[model samples]
Target chain A: MTTEMTHTTASEPVTDRPIMTPAVDVYENQDELLIVADLPGVTSDSLSIDLEDDRLTIYGRRKALCSEDTPVLMGGGRAFDFRRVFTVPEAVDAEKITASLEAGVLQLHLPRHERTKPRRISIRTAG
Target chain B: MWMTWNDFDRHFAAIDTLRRELERSVGGTRQSRRLGRWPEATLVDEGERFVFAVDVPGLTQDDLTIDVHNSTLTVAARRVVNPPEGYATHRSERTGFEWKKSFTLPAKIDGERTAANLEEGVLTISLSKLPEAQPRRISIA
Candidate 1:
């Protein structure tokens, strides 16, 4: 049996780095895996996803765009900064990975490698 | 230099009072401001397991904490705001409210092996059924 272990690390950075906290969903089907991430206030122009080796990274920045009519009693809060990293399994077909964003949710589809697909075997009857 | 000590004390007191009032007004306004409402969540049973979906956009895992105890599940997160330099205010729609939502799970679920994932602002949590909740097959006579 092959055992799979997934580890997640969460921390707070001391430096003046941007903060990104987008929620995500993952689903596995017979042939592929699907990932969805919610990034409200982020536009497509400011979103980016990159894959290197077996790691996938998602980044997005939401610019502050409050209207002139809004009153500014006090100002504080990172406009909108988001970043997430995931380790892809070797069975994933990296070349065919695709991602798209709609209404602030980012969707990613990772197809399984050809060799790892399931195959059926026929039983033989002998006299 | 020729002014009386009483005059100096009065001037300083006036400035101090003004500063105190300014600070009080700022604090009051901030406290009175509304943070906004939380979104609704739904759970459905799909034969094999129970699936829960919550609407919580723009929240990272670091900002969120999930807890399960005695068949109750709670999700809490704080949204931080760090305005940029030279950025001015415009229209505002997104709620700056910190969220803390919870749900009571059914007894049929296996609380120990629950799994959660967040995607596209929707948080989906799955709870597998307990062995007792699963259907059993009886031997034929």
Candidate 2:
């Protein structure tokens, strides 16, 4: 089992009215770290993932589906924008990160650095 | 080098309470739907058909089951959590949940004529009103 993940903070452009921090899940394996986020109502075209100075930021805007005339029988949070940031650890390979968005879920793959990966030890035969 | 939403609040606390309230209400962490324990949903009543939509992110059409018994419509689904192989979890804010929401419509609906589609994580279930339930103009001599 891997050790407890180190929690780091990230930064983003400040905006008024508060930003919705989309729920996120992060997992790490031998080769890479994966982050999955649920961003309902956000489209592929509107979503963006950026990594700067070891800070990874996920941004997206949700277009309102309900119209004015439509009567909303029940009201939910109704947030228009989503934002979340994470500070990348030293083990992460910053150069080779990939992301994809499907069905309102965003998945990010951050590979580990070649030097940081674990290596198997070879046994030598006694002479 | 690292910053979380908590740190951001330390920098500025404007609208902090509002943001927290919104998260609590929208996250569906508690206060399940009025009918029962289900995801947040909205219903729009059009003249011809009524549209019911719910926020079920990370769910496909196959994950849901919709059924209409009498005048009541029931929606049920389960979200599964699958972590990658040899993975060690860091943050786990999004968890799997089983949701079921049902509503009693004012008018009877044609069960066979219903249509449902899942797009961008939103599940839309549309039902057309029965012919007799639809409004019609009666002309008198």
Candidate 3:
């Protein structure tokens, strides 16, 4: 599993609000790889997904629950934003990658290159 | 890191005790807090009403149940994820959780006039203040 995943935690950002590392689920099969991330309160306009070389990054900002002036009587520390970085395999076809967001969950589909797919070999009996 | 809003000195002089009750339930440090406050919520007073909001991504209204009493509000939810039929799992970091959390409001509320909405994975519950509990303005003659 170490060979498949190569990622490091974030270094630093100058801000008082906490930035959360969103939880992600990765699934793979012969055809494609699926990545799902949870980012509540983030709309499509505030969410961004970027891929450069083999590193994939996801970023989203959480909308403020309370407007200003109102004191939070009972408060829970709401995370300011959600961000995560992952190292994707080189065999993936970056051109065919697609993504969709619904109900604050993002799904990314990465299809493998045609040459990397498994092939079957057959031999005919000699008469 | 985790920043809690302590803006209590603004207009909430009556609810001064709530300032000390601020939640430090952040980071995986304490076992009691880490396990208790799932889908943490923030309750605020909005003049005539109280607003409660919580982050519940991938959840709908059908998955949640909200109840409001005199000075307490309860929320119960069940989140379940079904994997793909024939897909191989590479990394599974997201999991489902079942929890019921209750919040204490600063003032008395009208339980019969509560409204709840679930939008874009955020659950917002609005509780109206009782007629006698709301503030009233009187103009000098």
Kindly provide the TM-score of model 2 when superposed on the true structure, using C-alpha atoms: 0.72
Task: Compose the digit string of candidate 1's lDDT tens values, residues A1-127.
Answer: 0111111225555655456445565666657777766676566788888889998888887654233443222222235467777888888999999988864667788888989876778988896
By DockQ, the best candidate is: 3
Q: Go through the candidates in order and give each one's C-alpha lDDT.
A: 0.58, 0.71, 0.73
Give the range where candidate 3 chain A is weakest over 10 consecutive residues by summed lDDT.
A1-10
lDDT of 2 by residue, B22-140 (tens): 34545553323211223656666665677777777889878999998655688898898787678999877776788665666655788988999898887888888888766566677
Query: How do all the candidates rank in terms of TM-score, highest first?
Result: 3, 2, 1
Candidate 1 CA-lDDT value: 0.58
Candidate number that wins on lDDT, 2 or 3: 3
Show the colliding residue pairs in model 2. A9-B2, A9-B3, A9-B4, A10-B3
Tens-digit lDDT string for candidate 2 (A4-59): 11122233336543355677889988899999988877888888888888878888
Mark the regions of model 3 whose C-alpha exceeds 4 Å error after superposition.
Answer: A1-11, A14-17, A76-79, A123-127, B1-37, B136-141
Ranking by lDDT: 3, 2, 1
- Find the 10 residues in a row with the least total lDDT in model 2 chain B: B29-38
Cα distance off (Å), candidate 2, residue B67: 1.2
lDDT measured at residue A42 in model 2 versus the true structure, 0 to 100: 80
